[model samples]
Target: MPLSPKPDLSIIVPLLNEQTELPDLFQTLADQKDILFELLLCDGGSTDTTRQIAVELGGENSFTTQLLDTPPGRGRQMNAGAAVARADMLLFLHADSRFEAPDTLSIALQYLTSRQSVSTHPVAARFRLHFRRRTTHPSLAFYFYEAKACLSSEDCIRGDQGYMLSRSCFEDIGRFDDSLPFLEDLRLAKTIARQGSWLLLPVRITTSARRFETEGLLRRQIVNAVIVNAVAVGWNEFFRELPGLYRCHTETGKLLLFPLLDGIRILLASFTPDQRRTFWQATGRHVAANSWQIFFWLDARHAFHSSLPPESVRLQWTNRFNRYCAPFVCSSPVAWVASAAVRLWHRAMLLLCRRLEPVTKTS
Candidate 1:
């Protein structure tokens, strides 16, 4: 494939240890011979021979390929690739992402071209996304996320969908925030939402769900919800701490318990409102019985503190306790009893505390 005098789009893939996935990714891009685009593979210091393979694949495919080196961060890598890119449009892709159909790039270009012809302002586009190799009957979590993205219009977007933006728009939105440890994609989407309109293309892209599989899908979703809420609520400290917490949990093999915990969450979620209320009361009793152990662990963990924001702390502790309590709650018939007992104890305790409150005296 010969290079065009001026490529219409520049495809930048930021990669790290993507040796196994690079072949399929590059092959997918190379198959789109009709799409005028330049391929830029920005390597984030991969110890594997990904760089060498990228070079070989580029030569075999005969597309304009430029291999770039950058520090190991997705934002920095993409920015580095974009700095040297020559196309008027930039499409950022993850190594494991693939076009859902052969016409994806062409359709994307048509949208951009049509938008540019009519509008004076810069335009951006993102494709609909689905997890690759999903079952015919996907999980509830899958539907939950996909529906949320579509319903949201443009407020939320997963990076795997691929972000296509004109050079002007990319610069105007201030580009991707490199300093963020993660969620740079969503951050960019939020910025784009504020700056201009987002073109939600009907075309879809398939992204790898390896992480969700390795870590329980539901647990990952819950974690994502907590982090997204943290970002929404301006609790930046909690957001910053999440990476460390994830690392700690992974090293300790705590992630193995996520599937079980998530299963219990699903089971509890399936209950009717009235049934849930009854279960919660039982859960309270169970908690009260283990109050001493809970207190000891909290003391050891230094979980109670006045300095940290109360809401943030509460959110973290609630999730942590749920993980530990899920196993007990999964036992036959015990969860119902625990929830009822716990609810009753909680009400009594609240009533006593309210009764003991001091009254103000007027002069």
Candidate 2:
């Protein structure tokens, strides 16, 4: 068939080693739910069967899928795919992500022609994720997150939430930063945010929770936190020196962190919602628990300090944690005074300790 005039939209999906999930993903697209659009799938080198699966799904002459070879890195692959898009709108989609509504492209096209997009930062749209559960229904928070994902703009996005951007908008913000290994989504968002209002439509897109299921929510959350914190400080710099940050250096650290996290989970279980409300009302935001597993820290006077013995450390820490968290819990001026006092005490002790300990010469 001869090439036609450029399509209205191109769904650019970047894939790498997604063999386990790629087929179902393509099948969703193959439904021709959005016939007016083109599918541009860019595959990075996959040691797994992902590329083969994609080829099979798309078939030799499938008018829908356009498979291309691109380098690894989600941002890099997406940028490469977007560059070749013949459509006026370029939607960056993940291989595992699925649209909850029918004709995803049809819904997105409506946004493209609208004047509402012009004044928006980065000028974008995204749908929410609805994970396919084989045995059970979706979780409470999952639905909430999915609901929020649809309406939140770049400032309020998670990477996996599907992004629909105009080709003009993509070019206006410059392409995704190919150099970033992680947190590339936020970098793209920041760039786009500088240009126009970050907009999230009410439409939802369902995506697999496989990453969290495979990696565990707590572990992934910690990793995400480290990445976000690192990006916030500066792009592409190591912040592993921060004790709370997670690093992939060793399985050994995870072994230790797991028990500490378990302790935290168990303690949280002990609180009734009403009791938790009372505790939270009494203590406030600064009431917390994270440093317990760090082997290097041992300051009793520190904010993280607990005089309770090692055997009772976990239990005691929980009590202290619930005690100090205030503003949301109590919202009292007394708590504010107490919070100020703690900060002053901490600063004074640090200064006093430094002055008292004479500097020693180092060879």
Candidate 3:
């Protein structure tokens, strides 16, 4: 089959040592139907056969596939891919992402283009995310997370959902932040939400949940919350001091949160009294902004039990909180109290994990 001279869309995927995941990813791309898309596989210094496999399998695929070597960072790799892509539309996807329907991209692109035509603001889209986990059993935590992914709330839209936007809009929003080794997607997500608007695409993108599973879902989520909190409060010391806070996908194991908590404790202690007060105040504001999650969790429970779609159920409590309570929670005193509560909760969780680790190993 001949490739289109100007493809309808450019699909950019950042790769590290993803040799194990490449075959399935390629197969899914190959299976994409009714879409004239070019595939740019940006390899970020994979020390494995990832590049070789991409070359071998890319040749077998019908689309225009190009492999480029880049520095070992997702943001750098994705930006490199976008710089050379021929299409007006760009879709950034994680290597572990899979599409259930062959026409997922086709429909997503169509929807995005349609929205762009009518809307004055720049439009970008992300698919609903589903975790392809190893287990078959129902988990309320996973369900809550999955439901949360469907919302357009701040910090809720993530990279794992597959970002699709026109190249012009991407340029307007600027390139992904490559300063840190991670959180580039998150930074861009917030930028888009601020500068333009996001549309939740109707299709779902299933991504491997190996990291969460291997690291223990609860543990991984807590670590993620910590990282997000650091980012929210401009806690540069956390990232600067602990550059390896986030491990690579292949290097994941049962996560130990004690070291992370201790690091935070040390960082807090090192801060001057004024700096500590300011940091806690900032953290309080972030916490208050996200306090809706507690109410949303209740809504999610009702939706889960009722077998309703994630967006279908909107409980009155969430509305009341937003209108009546959200403003009060953002106050400095309230923020300080919230910060104290968070610290207490953190210490409690650390103790719980310490007690549970030995039993988990024995079992």
Give one digit per residue, the lDDT tens place, for model 3 in 9-125: 999999989999999998888888988999999998888899899999988988889999898889999999999999999999999999999999899999999999999988899
RMSD of 2: 14.6
| lDDT of model 1, residue 183 | 75
Model 1, 1-363: lDDT tens digits are 774578889999998878889999987887774678899999988878899999888888767888999987789999999999999899999999888577789988888778877876667788776676545654444533443344334545768879998888899889889876567898898888777767777777778777676666755655664455445534454534334434312233323333323333444566689866655654444444443334333432332233321112233443465577645654646655655654465456445534553322211
Instruction: Report lDDT per candidate.
Output: 0.67, 0.58, 0.87
Give the TM-score of each candidate: 0.66, 0.64, 0.94
Question: lDDT tens digits, residues 56-98, model 2?
Answer: 8778435567788988778888888888899888788887777
Report the number of backbone clashes for model 3: 0
lDDT score for candidate 1 against the true structure: 0.67
The runs of at least 3 residues in candidate 2 whose Cα sits more than 4 Å from the true structure, single-residue gaps closed, are 60-62, 116-122, 147-153, 239-363
lDDT of 2 at 234: 43
For candidate 1, the per-residue lDDT at 188 reads 91
Misplaced by over 4 Å in model 1 are 1-4, 239-363
Model 3, position 135: C-alpha lDDT score:
82
